[model samples]
Target: MEQLLDYINQHSSSGISEKDFETVKSYFTHKKLRKKQYFLQEGDICRHFGFILKGSMRQYTVDDKGAEHVIQLAIENWWVGDRESYTMSTPSVYNIEAWEDTELLMISRQDVLELFQRCPAFIETVKMMDDRNNIANQRRITSSISASADKRYTDFINCYPNLLERFPQHIIASYLGITKDTLSRIKRQLLQKE
Candidate 1:
């Protein structure tokens, strides 16, 4: 709970007051997920939004051919959930799975709404997060269409160096819209240049 308070203090612009922090803490439930376990499955309503305290998770979609497409990855101190589902109580199109054994501080949608009502400052933080996510998705789409695979890999590495360390090569390749073989070759070329 102290860690969560500290996290809110550091990341949230308006910050959380001690009293408000306690209220926020009271709303959260601790949860654990083993590697490959899902926090939310496709077609289910994402009732909870999770803040990662430990380990990592990936939100992905599987095609009819069963190919996984990585959408987002959340590590410690990051938020994870299907925003549309959590906000609207609709079915989720993505699956959120633990990439490693994970611990999360989770709060239900109702609790989040109540918190926002009580702590108006939290609304600013959520809006900021939404804006950042929108920009990131737009950048990703633009990069996919306009950049070379090598450039995409380089940009991805530059943007998320730590994520490369936490996630598998195949997952990274998928996120960059490249095949594992292509990623391997790019790595070799990069190593040779280095």
Candidate 2:
């Protein structure tokens, strides 16, 4: 919770007040998940928004062919949840699973609406997050449509240098929308160039 407060302080026009923070903090509940445990499964209504205080998770979807496609990785200080599902009270089409033992601060959709009503600083935080998410989504769409496999791989490496060391090659390949073999080939070709 302190981390979240600090994040808001750093990003907001004026930091949140003690009274506002107190009100905002009450709406959140702490929870922990073990590795491989799911926070949300496909077809479940996403009721809560999660703020990762520690560890990592992946939001993904499995297709009819049973191939998993990663949508995003949520690390420390990141938010994870199906915004569409939460907003609409519809079933989620994605699953959010822990990659490591994770701690989260979560709030129900109702509480979120209340928080927004009471805390103006919280609205700034959400706006900043939304701007970042939009830019990322646009980059990903452009990368998928216009970039070559090798270029995509290079961009991924440059953008998330640490993820290569943290996640398995297969997971990274899946996130990059490439086969494991293709990832290996790209790595080998890059090595040859070096």
Worst 10 residues of 1 by lDDT: 120-129
Give the alpha carbon lDDT tens digit for every residue of 1-194 in model 2. 89989988877898899999999899999999999999999999999989999889999999999999998887888899999999999999999999999999999989977888999999898889889899999999999999999999999999888777767888889899999999999999999999
Point out where model 2 deviates above 4 Å: none
lDDT (CA) per prediction: 0.89, 0.92
Estimate, for each residue in 49-115, the C-alpha lDDT of model 1 and write its tens digit.
9989999999999999999999898899889999999989899999999999999999998887888
The true-versus-predicted C-alpha distance at residue 21 of model 2, in Å, is: 1.5
lDDT of 2 at 189: 94
Question: RMSD in angstroms, all models?
Answer: 1.4, 1.2
TM-score of each: 0.94, 0.95
